[model samples]
Target: MSIPFDRAPTATTDTQLSFDSLGAPLHEVTFVIVDLETTGTSAGKSEITEIGAVKTRGGEVLGEFQSLVKPEESVISPFVARLTGITHAMVDDAPSIRSVLPSFLEFSLGSVLVAHNAPFDIGFLRSACERLDYHWPQPTVLDTVTLSRRVVGRDEVRNHKLSTLAAHFGTEVSPDHRALSDARATGELLHRLLERFGGYGITTLEDLAAVRQAGWAKRQAKSHLAKGVPAEPGVYMFLDGTRRVLYIGKSGNMARRVRGYFNASENRGRMAEMITAAQEVSCLPCAHALEAEVREIRLIGELAPPYNRRSKNPERNSWIVLSDEEYPRLSVVRSTTALEKSSAIPLGPFRSRKSAQAVKELLDTLYPVKRCTARVTAATLAAHRPCVSSQVGQCGGPCAGVTDRQTYLSGIADLFDAMGGDFSSLRRLCTQRMTRLASEARYETAAEVRDAMRSAMSTAARAESAQALRAVPEILAHSPGPDGGLDLAVIRHGKLAAASHVRGSRAVADSSAAIRATAEWVPAPGPFPADTDSLPEETRVLSQWLQTATLITEQGAWSLPRSGANFHAQESGTVRLGDAV
Candidate 1:
């Protein structure tokens, strides 16, 4: 989820550009430091027992509101009673939440709400408002915990808990879980955070809001590294002083994105560390976002940058392949090198082992293929006994000579057909299993079966898409660019050969000619383009984009397969994979 900071207002008039953009000054803004003692941690299940708030402006205390609220629908748990020192006897004569909430709302009107852990307190208040049918005045909220992390380094405190922060800042009041004392401590901590932020140019609420979501001083200190970066759609590489690439990323606006890393918007801790180590920014301007994305994937796959988490190990992608034995069984393999030497039909280039295993499990459950690992040949059938899977009817009894070689081969052919594109067999079996599971009220297991079926279909669809693209020798496609022009790409085989952006209708023809002339030469790929330098991920990326693109020209066959993954059903929530096109 993105940060919930109040954004700077857009200037509506020429005179509103300068001082108005800064927002309300910190000292001038009315802030309500609030705290609540609750029955339990869960806002949905708990009730607030006490409320305390301090209204202040310009370092002067305006007023303090404190109340012991009687619970309407809940009793104070023994643990909470001891923690907050608020027993049932103490709040028995106190007012209920329904009466006290309205007054609290009136007291905190038109002010920024401040709390140590704002979510916990705000969640309880919102839940109360919802339960009591009161219109919640949605006030701007600030969490001192979030703000403290941005300005206060770890050297000063072990953690950003309320007690830790209050002690670190040497506040006059120490938090002891009582609502009023905690509120006072939180108010003091908020002032200290503001004081620390003054050197980082956080004088206004707008500045505070922008930096609240990220580390302030570290990013501000490294802001100059992004100054030389260009403003264009492209891939960027952040390098250390010795010129080693530390991180790789792609964005439409390179300058703004790079600058964001040095600002309060980029909150990722790893990214903050990368920015600190980065001394130089290198850019590779692309024709458009598509080219930038494709280039980024290839670079990450090749360079294996330490900072990039994904697309770095394309070679480690696993695939589910059927064994070439007489009684074929499903197995997951990483190297497609072995499949080249055997007649085993490969079903996937699945990104994760778990996905490939899920598909394998689904196929194993659907078909009566052999589940045992023992190589059951005609010569060894006399010595083999039926395995547990065969006894349970999950596998054909090929080892006990119950299933003949021709029959087993026929079943293997059907399995191969299902893996190729036809999902009828798997779909029929999965539907039955799901129905049975649903009847038994095992909805989670049914959902898992549903997901596995979807994954199987998706794997088949991906393979077919790649095969169709590789079959086509050449394809030139164009889409309406973001800048009101044409974005054209030259695809050879299944790989992106070249990309170009034409700014006007008149330049389309000339740009196309130049792009085609300068395009990389890609030979006719075989059944699979696994040997190609580009990752299969790149082809998958192009496949998604080409679904919406207009084909200006093409050579050889270029069409979506008749059968594809249909996870969505037009008629009902339950997927009828058998009816999928």
Candidate 2:
């Protein structure tokens, strides 16, 4: 659904589905009010003694389903006989549960199942389906007990228990611990609750589903915040009273998506907090889902909205940069701007600074690369002495003048080759080091070596993927739009430069031509292009889009590395491309 950006959607809104658009009106919905009398409380241990249901629509009775199910193993206790006026003798003549369950299921098919305490009755029915090997028609369920709690205040009804509600509502049929009587009472309660919900504009089955949600009143009251929000694919921002953004999200349907935040459909605890703090909902509608996603990523990165857990600080991500110096060394940096300043190749824009450091360590371990932080030059190298690392053979010690500049530089070249997806040397060295360490019983050090090796391999894989697209000077691609038609995008050097949405074959061609002509001029990217602004994420977004996109035009070779970052140990010290080992 990822499409180009900044274009007015050509697809008509009428065809787009939303929550309200799909719900069945309450009056049109058939509700099967059911009640079950069981020998015990637990569905696993209990046996249904009787099944009763009343199917109704628009307060009119459509049909009634009732059956007495004789228990196979257990008989009703004497206390239950006094409550329901039924016992083993009474159910002896009745059909067994296996014979009665199918008929009851058929009677309630295609209807929203309702019960006074739904879980108990529905659980028993579903459990019966499992035992009897009958396919349970997983119908929509409505619990009058939940509905009454939301509709009738505690002041009006002391408790939501069936007997309490039946008495409070003065039902024609009072619940008497019998299936038929309780079901008839529950049917009356359903209608009364529906009437109450109508006052709050809960006119459809979807609305009723939210009645059971905690903070139903608060959600209903805040529903107006969604007003005027366009029903289109877009990014939404929930702002607090001071107009500070509390949350940012994207959805195919902006209005419906935002509205859901104030409804039962959204149940995330942090979202509930965000909704409570939110005083206004604003949106930036897009042409399609992809544009929405891109905008969302960019916004989250730029704003770092507190509620958003991902992509908060694209700037905070760490990268392993090859330092631009007389004696080059690996260093961890926060921005890709270092790429523009130095002849350094960026290895990653890893989410964790620790992971980036791990890659640096892995590279240093495999190659006798410099580990010193001091800035050294040819002038300073003659005055320097061999460091501790040089004595231990971990570093080339170019600063000490012991290792010639050319020899140290040659080692760096091999290190760069490994970072550039040729992980053969790194794999072999780590494998040998790990085997040697385990033999010496240095298990923890071996584990550290393994982790560093993995971190390095992952960084290499990502760099390979990104560089493949960055090498392409230009690419024209199209994907199916959200509703209908095509989404055309012009990509330059792995960056989205222009995008448009159009309908019909003629319009697609026209838009494509216009987008290509008007596309922004982009210079060819440097090796290991930095993650400044949205470069890395945008490339990732484009890569995903191109995976399924139809290419109409291209410039330059857009080739990925042979194995692309799937580095694994292979025979003869060679590495195989697959998942990293």
Which of the numbered candidates is closest to the native, going by highest TM-score? 2
lDDT, candidate 1, 150-217, per-residue tens: 88888888999998888888999999999999999999989999998777656777557667654567
Where model 2 places Cα greater than 4 Å from the true spot, the runs are: 1-22, 210-212, 324-329, 337-344, 361-414, 428-455, 521-523, 527-533, 563-581
CA lDDT, every model vs. true structure:
0.78, 0.77
TM-score of each: 0.68, 0.84
Candidate 1: where are CA atoms >4 Å away? 1-208, 213-215, 341-344, 377-379, 564-581
Query: In model 2, what is the error at residue 206, expressed in angstroms?
Result: 3.1
User: Model 1, residue 54: what's the lDDT?
Assistant: 99
Looking at model 1, which ten-residue stretch has the lowest summed lDDT? 8-17
Cα RMSD for predicted model 1: 9.0
